[model samples]
Target chain A: MKLISVNDLSLQIEGYFAFKHVAFSLSQNEIIGINGDNGSGKTQLLEAIVSNKTPDSGTIDYTPGVRIGYLPQENPQVIEQSTGKYLEEMRRLSKKLAVRKDQLQAMITYMGLSPYLDTPVNQLSLGLKRQVDFLSAVAGHPNVLVLDEPFAFQSEKTIQRMLDLIIDLKNNNSGIILSATQFDKRIATNFDQLYLLDGDLKNIAAEQKNEPVSLLVFHVSPNSMAITPDVEDFLVSNQDNQIELEVPLKKRQIILNKMVQLNYQFEGMRKIEN
Target chain B: MKIRILLKSYLQLYFQNFLYLTMLFSIIAFELLANHLLEIGNLKKFSLLLIAMFILSLFSTMNLYYNDSRQNKYLKQKINSHWADWSSQLLVAVITNLFSSILIFIFSLLLRDNVLVDFVGILGLFSVGFLGSGIATLFQTQWYDHSTVGQIGVLLFIYLAFSGSVVNILTAVEWLLPPLSKIIMTLQVTSSITKLLPIVGQTLLYAMILFFISGLVYKKNRKNA
Candidate 1:
């Protein structure tokens, strides 16, 4: 069943165009990864889904009784109070979800935040604060999770823990939509559905099953490259190069090897798999 | 449930700021000492002091609410929690005013050698002032930038309508039709308002009216929210 459906949705921010006629659906237990370059309306799309921004024109249909949880790219200001108080408050607000008070404490512990529970949030590191905010959103046990840049500023272990939490939520029949610039291969391997926004307001359609994927695109500097992959493909580009290559989805190791062998200073890489 | 959660969180925040609480207590103590040294027994003086306390408490509550609103987690979770928005503001106003009143009551008994009558009067003033302030905050939150002017205007109109003798001229000329005119007239005089209605009754009435008005404003704001 589709938990969230957005049809012909468009949004504009500060008179600058953000998204246009964007359409997508999130099914039960499906994890949809949204990949795009910076300023590609990835965050705006996530915000629109959570009702933070009203679409300029379109229809958004959400499943009744299905809660939507969003973690924005920018960390919210930390309350000058202790982490425990923050988590307790979140737990109280989400009390209708059958979450036990101890579970909240456990989640804090799992995030390596147990010792910091009594410490003021403002005193914590930026990464720790982000973790706290992330836990708060998931603690509500939302049926549809919308996470924006969950790995930003997070350590590898913390990212792994967050991934585990997402998998756990998925096992509980919850759907997840994540947007990030750099796509973790583990996440792409685990999550099948993918959407790409290519410096435009709309989502670029995925490549067909029978077609041979286009591997590279040559364009002027600053123009976003396009990828037509049969499945999901990873792209690793040189820092000075203008052309972008589409690495086979399963051969990320090979792409990494090629980049290293070519001695090309890489800008960034992401996986587009669905 | 959301209100309960917000209330709990607010109280926790209050406790966390122990230094602020200490400073607040010291200020209250200094005021009580000043009042005792002046030997002022007039109701007007007492009412003015009560008003000052009310403003102080309201300022503190607003500070806390703004702080909580800045919290990313709180704002994210609370936007969907209907109870959090209304009840948090209401609880802050009510609780802070009640605490201030209680402190004043205790101070009056200890320093002024006043009877239970003065204690009750102070309680009534606190209650009415709390309700009025709560209603003001509700308006302020809903209207955002214009709340300050709007609240001041509303309070000024209420005071003028209730106490201004000019109201009688309008009534005599049959030029103005006012609701609650009789009640305002009855309570226009301080002695009658304090004497006829017990402090509890006056406070309850004020609280009820303010709460009702706030409820209406909140309903309208929630639709916009």
Candidate 2:
């Protein structure tokens, strides 16, 4: 299902262009990773789509009655609310986007947030509060999940869990748009589509990108390299007088055939250990 | 149901933060009763107590209105954020201010107070409170962006409006905001509110307009949020 379509969106603040001539459409069961450097307007683009910022010109059409959940990049300014009440109040405000109690409990348990549920939000560490913000956005099971740096200020394990959560939501037909300044191979690989927003939203086609399977590094010795069965099963890279072999998962045989067909020479077969 | 949820949750928060004003009012009320320096009759004293509560309520209500958004943003992130938008925040102002005002009035009434004034005074205070909340809510939303500037502007306006007759200068344009006119009249001369109906009518009218306009601000903010 087409969740939202943005057309020719443009916004400027303080006479500086935040974004211009940006357009994108989101559909169900898709995870779109927006990549950019700081001040490159990744967050601004998400804001435009999430309805937080009005554009100077453009139209945003959402399929009628679509629910959205957003987690901002900053820790939400919370003073008096406990983590539990914070989530509950946000859930209430989002009427018709009901999330059952058990589901919240499950996420809480998984995040080890059970102990901090009743803790005042401001009093929690930044990372804990960030998780609360994450839950507030994801708990309602929104049709469109807009996460801006949701994994920031957290552990690697938590990041993995959040990535899995996005996948789970996608499998359930939710459209997820994630804005991340930093890149991770696993996360980048998981995105159905990647976009680099630098004033303009540019699509990084999925097929043109390769997921790293294996990295094989070796020393190149001027035509003294020997191509053997062991050395043939990898991709070859010649850089700075050194040759590195990269082996794509399950394509080692094809790489071997390519090396043999090309009459490629290598010093020795190597697989870099992690 | 949604409003109920937001109201209830915010009310809980209000009760917590409202302690500052409640304690302030309680201390002042007790000192007045203990020192025996107030020479007025019991009714006047009780009325004065309610007025004090109302004033404190106004201060705290403004504080709540300003801090609610500054402090928490969970509701702001939700899809249907109207529950915690400026209008709803103003509703919290109304509810908390009224709650404290009425509670003080009733509690003071239980004390021995002879020679009671008519309901006009209470009605006048109530209308003033409604007006105060309305204006405060407006400041909390529209003027809130420029914190220091807005606070200074509002304080100046409130002082000029209540102390002198600046509202009268703006009265020709006041019909658009009838509440300010009513507030001016009510504060200028307490006896003027004896008729009561016009005051109440203007209170409702002004409150509706403020809420409606602030509601638009909410929609606009949500659109850009």
Candidate 3:
């Protein structure tokens, strides 16, 4: 059964179309991965799926009475309260939804959140905050789980445990929707379906495909509007504050040197084909 | 069940914050110190002083309701009911204010100052507390990060309230506000229970309307965010 279906969706941010006419669906026991570059509207699309964001135009139909759990990318504004109390609140809400969280306590211990349970959520490290959010989402045993960058800021062992828990949820017939910058081998191997959200959602093969390309992400000073270096040929996309360039593998070093010579602050460089 | 959980979370958050704890205790301290210094001789003066303290404390702590994107997003995703999170916070605000009123009433009772008059004063305190919190919630929900605008709105409300008495023309426009002036007038002009009942009803009615409007505005703003 289709747990959720988003059709002809359009979302605009800061008066620019983040994505237009996007469409997708999820079914029971299915796990879908949405891959995109930074600021490609991956998070926005996940939020829309969970009904946290309103689409500019479209319909996101959900199966009646299907409970959803969402993990936001950050929790800087979370209310000041002990982590234990926060988790207790989520547990109560889960009970209200009629979901049994028998293993949830054990999971909390396993995640190393036990010692800091009395600590305030805001005082916790960034990685721990994200784990708290992940646990909150899992406690509900939601019919649909929407996680944005769930694997971020975690150790190898923690990431493995999270992946195990997610797979277990899938075994129990929970559908999952998650977004990531890129799918590593482990992710590509486990994910049942993969969608590339460049400008719209497109179903891509599960395996990571390599192309002869590299991505150059750079930041320009907010006050400066002009790039002193002439690299229009390599420019893939440019926004007011950042620019992305698609460079050939052989020319990547030349482009980096030129940008460094011109004093442009390079944010990151990643191989497009990995 | 959802409301209870949300209410508990909000209250826990409020009580845990050092600033919120300071504001709440400061209200109590101010009541004790001011009562001793002013030598409140009657029920009316005592109640007025207590209610003024309540309003001040409420205004000071209401900034906690300023729009927080992260917390709002978390609640919006976790809670099933749309109004549960907002209504829960408003309930917490009212409950804390009520706590101050009850403490004041108990003190008045212990002092053995005309039980009937003290009861009436407590009733008046309830109405104003609701009115003040309602107006503040309306502004907070309607404006994102509403510190500046909320301050301006509060100043305007205070002006309209006091001006209604000094300037005869402003009395006609006073009815549109949360009936703070009316509550004060009723407590001051007549201790008659009948006159006070109608004012209580009017204040509660205005508060309910403001709450309803705040809910609507909250939903709209949440969607836009």
Model 2: which docking level applies?
acceptable
Q: Pairs clashing in candidate 1?
A: A192-A274, A232-A273, A239-A265
Instruction: Give a tens-digit lDDT track for model 2, residues B1-225.
Output: 456555654565556566646665684566446336656544445435534543564465566665566544545445354634554566776766556555554454433242233354455455556656665665665334557755874575456434442445665755554354344444444443345457566765666676676577657755554
Would candidate 3 be rated incorrect, acceptable, medium or high by CAPRI criteria?
acceptable
A131-219: candidate 2 lDDT, tens digit per residue:
88888888778899999988788898988888888898899889999988855655677888888888877886543344335554445
Chain A only, candidate 2, TM-score:
0.75
Per-chain TM-score of chain B, candidate 3? 0.77
Ranking 1 against 3 by TM-score, winner: 3
lDDT digits (tens) for residues A165-213 of candidate 1: 8888898889999998857655676775767776443333344333243
Model 1, C-alpha of A150: deviation from truth (Å) = 1.2
Backbone clashes in model 1? 3
Q: Where is the poorest 10-residue window by lDDT in model 1 chain B? A: B174-183
Better model by lDDT, 1 or 2?
A: 2
Q: By TM-score, who's the top model here?
A: 3
**Which residue pairs does candidate 3 place in steric collision?**
none
Instruction: Indicate the TM-score of model 3.
Output: 0.74
Alpha carbon lDDT of each predicted model: 0.64, 0.65, 0.72
